[model samples]
Target: MNAKELHDKTPDQLREELASLKKESFNLRFQQATGQLENAAKIRAARRNAARVKTVLNQKAAAAATDAE
Candidate 1:
């Protein structure tokens, strides 16, 4: 997913998506180890998407913490 799309997601939704991506990454890694992975680019895409979600989550958390201060 793109950064703009990721940023538009609610915090909870981002978290859920991140969790799903991580699970998918794990499976992708297993596939690669077994020489069954057809799309190597998918692993990179998943990593970037997971990072974007994490960045959004961290940004939201920081904003909330600052607001609470």
Candidate 2:
């Protein structure tokens, strides 16, 4: 939902959540097309959450890479 929550999750949990968010985004789009979605802001929120997940994953990967060097 937010960076604080995202950052607090363990790496494995973050990965799981990322996958779930992506799936939800896809469903949201489907609902939008079918005229079931009410709030447009939800799509934006989902997208932002997806990005937050990605940023955290990248940070972890980069940290690991730096440690190897």
- The candidate scoring highest on lDDT is 1
lDDT of 1 by residue, 1-69 (tens): 688998788999998999999999999999999999999999999999898899889999999999999
Q: For this target, which candidate reaches the highest TM-score against the unseen true structure?
A: 1
How much does candidate 2 score in TM-score? 0.90
Please report the TM-score between candidate 1 and the true structure: 0.91
Q: At residue 20, give the lDDT of candidate 2.
A: 93
True-vs-predicted CA distance for residue 47, candidate 1, Å: 0.8
- Name the regions of candidate 2 deviating beyond 4 angstroms: none
For all candidates in order, the CA lDDT equals: 0.93, 0.90
Q: How accurate is candidate 2 locally (lDDT)?
A: 0.90
Q: Which tens-of-lDDT digit does each residue in 1-69 have in candidate 2?
A: 678888788889999998999999999999999999999788889999999999998898898899999
For model 1, the superposed segments whose C-alpha errors exceed 4 Å read none
Residue 13, candidate 2: C-alpha displacement in angstroms: 1.1
